[model samples]
Target chain A: MALRFALMIDPLAADQTAPDLATTFTAVDPAAPALTVGELSTQRGDGIFESIGVVGGHPQEVEAHLERLVHSARLCDLPEPNVAQWRAAVAIAASECGEGEGVVKLILSRGVEHGPTPTAWATAATAADFSLARTEGIRVVTLDRGYAIDAPARAPWLLLGAKTLSYAVNMAALREAHRRDADDAVFLSSDGFVLEAPTASLILQRGDTFITPAPNGAILHGTTQLSLFEHLAARGFETAYETIPVDELRRADAAWLVSSVRLAAPIRQLDGADLTVDAEFTASLNDYLLSPRD
Target chain B: MALRFALMIDPLAADQTAPDLATTFTAVDPAAPALTVGELSTQRGDGIFESIGVVGGHPQEVEAHLERLVHSARLCDLPEPNVAQWRAAVAIAASECGEGEGVVKLILSRGVEHGPTPTAWATAATAADFSLARTEGIRVVTLDRGYAIDAPARAPWLLLGAKTLSYAVNMAALREAHRRDADDAVFLSSDGFVLEAPTASLILQRGDTFITPAPNGAILHGTTQLSLFEHLAARGFETAYETIPVDELRRADAAWLVSSVRLAAPIRQLDGADLTVDAEFTASLNDYLLSPRD
Candidate 1:
């Protein structure tokens, strides 16, 4: 079976030179595209973004994605992009999507023209490949130091949950994890609460309850995880938004990383600790994901 | 004399669509002068920017600006750009700069790319009119909501003192101040500390005691401020990096906004409250500004 992807990744064995991804993608058309870039970044560092998997010539759950995009933007105190324009742009980009499944990303920034104004926003889509997920569930690491979101004032400015452009720290944390010979990283709040894995959703099962961090101002409200909740609910699993303690998760029935690309990847081993319930939950979740979303 | 500017307002009325300031300036390159829209933006907003003003039309202080750029990039945790390439790009841009007391601005940004990764940054330069500073001192409003730099882990993430692309908040604050019928805005930290004015350097008072927020972590270290400090030392004024409360500033013997563009603008008011600082400091600072360094 051939894989479908939004991004085309040339295999390490392929001969052709990788395209200058940066320069080639910019539009020559000035007026609208100009507005798009600025508006997309309107929230300064208080916006949300999604990099999703487009499979079998269809961007799965696009409606759900757009819905979350709008919700995330509003929560971040940003003016919404015209939904029609957004849908059209995504559809136009999706139509030209090449062979195989790839990745499509959406960003909603503070739309502040001068970087501090906070007025406009822009959203653009790009297709890329991530077949790497199919072969290996990422080797994840944990940060010894954690983020502090202890105050209400801190809550408003703690842009981590909003997925804003102020992503340097988060990316830095991931890089630190990578440097430690880990594929990805999970952040713990300074008080030792398990926060999140960089750029993906979290779901841990303890008996019948599927638990993750509450999508309050402290955590990014992930669309993929919300969708998975529906399946968990129908299957008689109690879904929850309460904070799951690190100790509890390590002892949970099963744990999985849910994201658009690797729909449900089992947490094979976390920080060298083997998770016992990986296989059963991994198979069940994959079966549900392979079924049509109608 | 008729002023040459990219967007100068008519003093007589709101004639925003006046004839071109220069008949020779064109949208194209070479004999006809050209400027990118992004270049025009550096002058707008209380936009935090570094300019080692032009000398004989050649951009001086490239190293200083580059050093500050890297520092700003680090403060904002932005991906490092190729400094050598940037230097070469600015040199090429500087060569295109025509003479007559103008400044060359090196504006670094996330460029037009969207998503998790940023596209390459670009720099452009254009001639600026310095005559505006030779005449008028600016009017400014002081805002009391000061900057956030108290958090131990997060305070280091404050981009206050660096000239970064995320300047929309400053621009918006200026607009808010303008809407309140003020020319510009001065930022006051939450603790009543008198930080730097929106675009310019801090206002220090008396001969031996000048006050501005310590560049410890909260403010962009101003190149012009550094120059002023050097001259202040030579003139027997002891420049100290101590935090001055807003109440002390309101009662200061004198105050002025120092910057590359305004050079030295005497602060006539703090918010709507009046200031009694004499205009002589503006002249002395101006002298220090135009005087060639050894």
Candidate 2:
């Protein structure tokens, strides 16, 4: 299949192509068809993706997201995406968001069968409101991720480190959480150690210090959590990365699931057991998360 | 996004819409843009699919594939497909393949974000040549599937048995096998039990009895393996399904990775060690596989 996105950028009226490639991405209609029937993105889910939270038309943590995108590309053996082209695409996507909290998804597929180029695109959509989730916090259920903590190291092919488009398991875990009457889920490794949420990273407050599971190949290294840790460090609260046991979670004074779009949402209850939700502390964290980052 | 496939089947002209949905599916151009960028299939890999082997214009194991399709939908919570429509689509897909072996892939995606209906279609393509693999047999390596055999039953949301399109790990395992200088890979459960292949089923011939892993919700129920077992039983060979351990494979007199498209390819070697490859027996199995079946 020919690159439909490439055709959208090539020889045609500047109006048809939308002015200039330097200033604009291929103008796309959300209601129009964009990918071929054989694109691997849809066919095999052989692709990598990132969802950047855009606030007030300003994309957050672009560098970190782009770095992780490159890392995911390496892990998946997908061709490294051209950072300049993607940055431009992300700009185009951010412009489409207009204002307020939005999410811009950057996707890089292995492309159609035997096609010359990878299918790359950015889509911007309005973010779902997580005001209640951020304030009142969220109820979470812990589910087994079905892999040992060291599995990713032993079996790199499992792709535990990559942020791939093959997120059916992640989506299913959320559904399972809802079935258990909780709003979200935190995944545990098969050998009974804490991991992260399907779409987010986990950070727990133990007395005074904050701790998250170490980035040991079994989990996607959390960009938001890193930035939050930096912010916490600046505020004189100790932060660390550790191998968290399942029991350590219960001992946590407070917990939060941190992500790009929803920011920091405190865990009000985990498995029907109440956790200390410091409303004031969580608001401070959210406020910091909402702040402009370069 | 609008249903582009539906648009292909809708009115402007009968030539445009094709003959009839009852007899013919919407005539599709394989290279054309058929899916929107927002589709959950591409976005989250949230979909179910089946690839049926078609030989001499006859689709093999139609009822079994359709039954599995329904089983997958139930596990994934997707809308139960209209069987009659899918059967007609399959016939149309099968017709697209002329005189040789071909593959018709049926995909039912969760559709575009907020779309009213699921996006469904079938695409017909020429099968890859597996002559060398089928005749000389293939070298196989074992990789950990990262889940215990009982994990599927314990966690229904893991979608262990469902034939979903989130096959990144499956694709990755094959890459790992190739890197290790092997042609294919067999998945072993983390708790030391034989699972299936990334895209095929495993059958071991221990002495006179042919055995496959039991369908205990851990591995997929292979349609091709089941057909082959039935054929073997008819030939007066004993056939059984049992919980095969990883050790039992090495002790087996012979083994084969069976699937649609590729059919039956015997295991010539396991992790560089030679296994007994019975050329005449494998050829007979392929002959049965290639025979016209409703």
Q: Which candidate gets the maximum DockQ versus the true structure?
A: 2
Per-prediction TM-score, chain B alone: 0.73, 0.93
Deviation in Å, model 1, residue B58 alpha carbon: 4.7
Residue ranges of candidate 2 with Cα displaced over 4 Å:
A1-24, B1-25
| Model 1 bad stretches (over 4 Å) | A1-50, A71-80, A106-136, A139-163, A187-198, A243-257, A262-277, A286-294, B1-60, B70-88, B95-103, B107-122, B125-207, B217-219, B243-278, B290-294
Best by lDDT: 2
Error of 2 at A71 (Å): 0.6
What's every prediction's RMSD, in angstroms?
A: 11.5, 4.9
Summarize candidate 1's per-residue lDDT along A194-245 as a digit string, tens digits.
7777667778888888898876556666667877899889988899987656
lDDT of 2 by residue, A100-142 (tens): 7888888888777776357777788888889999999999999
| lDDT (tens digit, per residue) of candidate 2 on B99-184 | 78888888888887776347877888778888889999999999999998889988888999899889889999999999999999
Residue pairs in candidate 2 whose N, alpha carbon or C atoms collide under 3 angstroms: none
Clash count, candidate 2: 0
